[model samples]
Target chain A: MRIRERIIETGLFFSALSSVFITLGIVIILTYESFGFFKEVAIVEFFTGTTWMPLFAEPKFGILPLVSGTLLTTAIALVVALPLGLISAIYLSEYAPHRLREMIKPVLELLAAVPTVVYGYFALFFLTPFLQNFLPELSGFNAISPGIIMGIMIVPYVSSVSEDAMKAVPMYIREGSYAMGATKFQTAFKVVIPAAFSGIAAAFIMGISRAIGETMVVAIAAGMMPNFTFNPMEPVQTLTSYIVQVSLGDVPHGTIEYRTIFAAGMTLFLMTLFFNIIGFWLRKRIREAY
Target chain B: MTRSAIELKAEAKNLNFYYGPVHALKNINMPIERRKVTALIGPSGCGKTTFLRCFNRMHDLYPHNRYEGEIILYPDKINIISPEIDPIEIRMQISMVFQKPNPFPKSIYENVAYGLRVRGISRKGILDEAVEKSLRGAALWEEVKGRLNSLAVDLSGGQQQRLCIARALATGPRILLFDEPTSALDPTATSKIEELIIELKNEVTIIIVTHNMQQAARVSDYTAFMYLGEIIEFDKTDKIFTAPSNRLTEEYITGRFG
Candidate 1:
């Protein structure tokens, strides 16, 4: 029995260690490639410079445009998703009849199953033209279309997580609030939402990270030029798309452009890491004993 | 029995509650007097809590498969079970303290003030006054006053129960329903809650579900003994305790059977 227990303990230890090793491996690769790029590019210039035309004859390595593009699309996506997803989550968890909730939840999750490429094509082929009529500033391939599609893609994550958090709250608490003569809306918003604050906050932050990390949808529809403008109508190239564009071309494996994309990958990784840290902190620090 | 002009705060007549197809409460008929404490005592699964919950229509949260009953609330005399009557509005006038002390993961001040906040009472001075009054009413003011901003979960179990009571009272509810509020507390905390219930009878009509016979005898003006989803006997506390008209009530109160 003791030998069997020791074997099980060793297996669990390796399982935990594997994740740490994988993370260290990715960080090492990112640091190695990005370190090589930094030798040619100044840190200040990478952060402050506006253009990101690494393929040009006079290669400009300012990463701000790509960062801004990533921020813009992610912000738009979060703006579209956070409230819509949270409200749907509340409705599904708190208001919907149990049978209806069961029926609708899987269907809402079905949105996540659609390939990101399909969402990209749909944004490029269908929504961009449709939106162009209303907002004539919209181009054939713009951040707005993909931002909206990415928001649609991420609704399931926000709703599922937020709904789970809200549901995790003890039912009697909501009942207590309702017993005080609070309307369903008031109980949901004021009581359940506040009780589930950490969970909902974490879900929202994860949504931001997911939106920032989303690739194919933005790559297909958000254009190729890394424009720094906030105008949703203007085309913008996010970090993920830039990496995709560079990798698709014949930039030699050891070339500066090849090294440049890794720097961009490192930046995306850092931003996602930062968001996740904040989310983890919130979830961990919650004073919810009940 | 000089009860010609006594006003009733709430009344339930031929009320039946169902959980899907299972009848949880069968034909409950009772009248709640204003400014009085009524205690419902019964064995587990005898529908004591279900009857107390019907006062505020708590089952309305899951309206899909809950109840079939007419709980006629006095003053308005509105049929609380009717589809047209908003349970939201009914809940505002009636508040409940649960068996387990379920305080929100918030500060003591916020926990007590949430009910007032829900009613759109945003004035700081008013909320402060109301929170203080309610906490004091629940007998938790002196203990919690020094650090009202502290998270309520930091409090002891007894204090959490009082905080829940204060939360219920903060709404200035005309009627307060308690479903075994003291069942989770220590004996000392239980007595404190019992004393608070006696004091609260001056302001609000209260219906309590308790397994503790001594608690009911001490706190309640009226005692109801229930069995199998029906009230076998309900009478003045002394009469129910000393000489219950029903054999089951006498047997149960005498510790012969539950």
Candidate 2:
């Protein structure tokens, strides 16, 4: 019996360690390639230069345009997802009737299950054309449509996580607020939301990170032009899209063009890492608060 | 403290409650006197807590919980059970402390001030004063005075319950219900809460449900013994403890089959 139990425990320990091992492996690979890329191009030029014309003459290694594009789409996605997802979470956790909640929650999660490539096609083929008619200024493959679609795709992440956090709050706290004469809305917005603040903040960060890491939709719908402009209606090339652009072509291995994708990947990795750190800190702070 | 019996704070008439089809409270009729601590004592699952929650219509939180009959509040002359009467308005006048100390994840002052803040009392000075007064009323002012902005959850279990009391008190409710408020506390904390409940009666009408017969005897002015969703006996603490009314009440209080 003891031997069997030991074997089971060992199996469980290794299973848990696999996730950590995978993360470490990715970090190591990213760091190794990033180091190789940095040895060729000056780090300052890669970061500070505004132009991202890596394919053209002189092959400028400026990553600002790529980073800016990434930020633009992520910002748009966050703007759409955060409020809509939070409201949906509130309705699911607090207000929606039982049958409605049961029916809608899975459907909301189904959005997450849908392939990102499908979403990319929808953004490129359907959403852009549909939106173009209303606003003539919208380009054929603008950042706005893809960003909006990416936001819709990631809504499940925000809502499901936030709803779970809100649900984890003890019922007695809500009862305490209600006993003090707070209305349903007041209790939900004030007591429940504040109690679940850390979780909600973590959810927002996770959603933002997901938006930043998203590749397919931006690759398909957001144009390959690395314009550093803030206009959502115009085409822009994010870090992920540029990587996709290079990978799709027959760029020989060990070339500067190939190395630039590593540099961009490192930047994207760092940005996501920063968000994850914030989310971790918030989750830690809330653990102390409760 | 004794007050005029005629000056009833709340009265229930044939109150019956059901969770779905299962009847939880059966024909509960009682009067809660003004400025008196009334203890509802019974075995587990006897509907004592349900009866207490009915005072503020807390069961309305979930769907399919049916409430029959009327809970009348005096001075306001309001029927608490009527659909026309808003539950929120009733809750403002009658607050509750739970079996477990469930303070909001906020500072002590904010927890106390939450009730007032929800009612739109935004002035900093007014909020500060109310926080101090409510904390003092709950007998936690001296201990917590040093860190008014410290998180409520940082405090001890005893202090958390006191914080919850302070929270309820800040709303300036006319009645306070304690649903086994000291069940999760230590003996010292339990005694402190009992004393606090008695002290609070000078300002607010008190309705407490307890499984401890000794606690009910120690603090209550009026004691109601409930058995299987029915009030087996209801009388003054002295009469209920010393003499007897129902044989079932006697047997149960004397450690017979509950």
Interface C-alpha root-mean-square deviation, candidates in order:
1.4, 1.1
Over A173-218, each residue of candidate 1 has an lDDT whose tens digit, in order, gives 8877778777889888878888888899999999999999999999
lDDT of 1 by residue, B1-258 (tens): 234556888878889988888888999888888899999998888999888877777876675446666778889889887778887787888889999998887799999998889888999999999999999999999998999999998999889999999998998888989999898999998888898999999999999999999989999999999999999998889999998999988889889887
Return the top candidate by lDDT: 2
lDDT (C-alpha) at residue B220 in model 2: 93
**Tens-digit lDDT track of model 2 for A1-290:** 99999999999999999999999998888888889888988999988999888878878888999998999999999998999999999999999998999999999999999999999999999999999899988999888999999999989999999998899888888998888888889889988999899999999999999999999999999998899888999999999999999988988888878878788989999999999999999988766545
Candidate 1 chain B, which ten residues in sequence have the lowest lDDT sum? B60-69
Residue pairs with clashing backbones, model 1: A181-B91, A181-B92
lDDT of 1: 0.89
TM-score of 2: 0.95
